[model samples]
Target: MTAVPQPTAALLDGTALARELTARTAESAAELRRRTGTAPCLATVLVGADPASVTYVRMKQNSCAKAGIESRHVALPAEISTAGLVDAVTALSEDPAVHGILLQHPVGAHIDERAAFEAIAPGKDVDGVTTASFAAMSFGLPGFVSCTPGGIMRLLDAYDVELSGRHAVVVGRSPILGKPAGMLLLARDATVTYCHSRTADLRAHLREADLVVAAVGRPRFIRGEDLKPGVVVVDAGYNEGNVGDVDFDSAAARASLITPVPGGVGPMTIAVLLEQTVEAAWRQLVS
Candidate 1:
């Protein structure tokens, strides 16, 4: 009879860490208000009526309120042209009162997503969707990072997960999450591999990973059989009802450390967004 593998890695509790970060952000926001006589502000743009997108944007706004930051929401019709979306984002980018801008992704198939993302200025791109933000993240520079990836790193740090010289395999290559996530891990000295829709034999890669990040949107994309024993797993994908890309039940059994979907990466994303908004406000005041 085969013995079950015992988890050597502990669960990465993103919820607790996010709470700490939120407290810090709230304090920073208060300080910024004192110093600049203005609270930090975040502008969220939602095109059309994607239920998930609306929920996410609302979550962000609620988090901002908790952190004592102001939120401005922009809602556009689904049939709005690409140019119209770009114009909206650009207007938010230029708004002096708005320190951070979040353009909810998957705006619409008819709209040009890249153009809309690029319309956000690098400094104000708190959601970190702009090309400039991606370049900065890839280069390991001081800039706003994509919320999900940034949150994952924070969770790893909070848990003291060693990234240096470790094998980190990211299962996805979406510009917002997977691709930049791998780059961030690489910057920390992890030997990172990126697997996407085109990757052949994903299980082979997962077997070699010391750290695995499941960012693909498909639920239960990475199974327990694919993971190496004691591997650290960061599940960043959020489907309906806070489901992740990983098969949590199976992956948790194999993983030494893992992040739960709803309470895991989700809260941290909003925490990072609020924290970066305060940082942006500080930068704006200094300039």
Candidate 2:
């Protein structure tokens, strides 16, 4: 008899799921527009001319158009002071025409990122970067979630992955991504453990995880050897050259379900953003 190779893990196809979600959001947007003459508007704030940031903003704008949402952009010079950035964001928050506000991350080292984020009204913080939003998410209250973390949960649900009472190890602690991810998992009754760069004995944690969320922003930081068999992996990192935080090939070999880099978490993030923008608009325009 010929030898047969063991099957690899199933792909968590975020692209297909995102398309479905976007279509649903577009329908809601159209209905909202039919009821009221105004369409949903999302304001995007970009600082400097960073290539990666520019590309991300463009992608989001394009997605907005497809989903029947209007996009307003504010471009600030690289040398803009923290107070100046805050003033710009505050203006958007006060604008009745803008339903949701998205401030691109890493504005500048010289700028007060937190202050700029705080300037966005709690209701208009569609990107979910404000402390209010974070608190809401942590407490499982009704609020917009951080986009990438929201996407990860949707992906897990789409595949029918069980989270309750399972050990979920998140291998990063970014305010928006990793921290919120762990909290969301915890809300679902999953036992959550967070590990960061300075954490001691990282592999030991991975060995026990039933679910692993890789958001460390390092390419191939988590190896297959570290993961126990049949674990679920969500690679939320997008590094240079389209690589993810996990070594996909190696991790897939061990994982029962895994998300790919470009097609996995990327599309879902935009989908969730568009969804939240339309929802925000509906709230502001309808009731």
Clashes of 1: 1
Report lDDT (CA) for all predictions. Answer: 0.89, 0.94
Candidate 2: give its CA RMSD in angstroms.
Answer: 2.2
Candidate 1 residue 220 Cα shift, in angstroms, is 1.2
Which candidate leads the pack in lDDT?
2
Q: Summing lDDT over every window of 10 consecutive residues in candidate 1, give the lowest-scoring window.
A: 2-11
Q: Worst lDDT window (10 residues) for model 2?
A: 2-11
Q: Write the per-residue lDDT of candidate 2 for residues 1-287, one digit (tens) a residue.
A: 95433449899999999999999999999999999999999999999999999999999999999999999999999999999999999999999999999999989999999999999998898988999999999998888999999999999999999998999999999988999999999999999999999999999999999999999999999988899999999999999999999988888889999999889999999999999999999889987
**Best model number under TM-score:** 2
Off by over 4 Å in 1: 1-9
Q: Estimate TM-scores for all models.
A: 0.95, 0.97
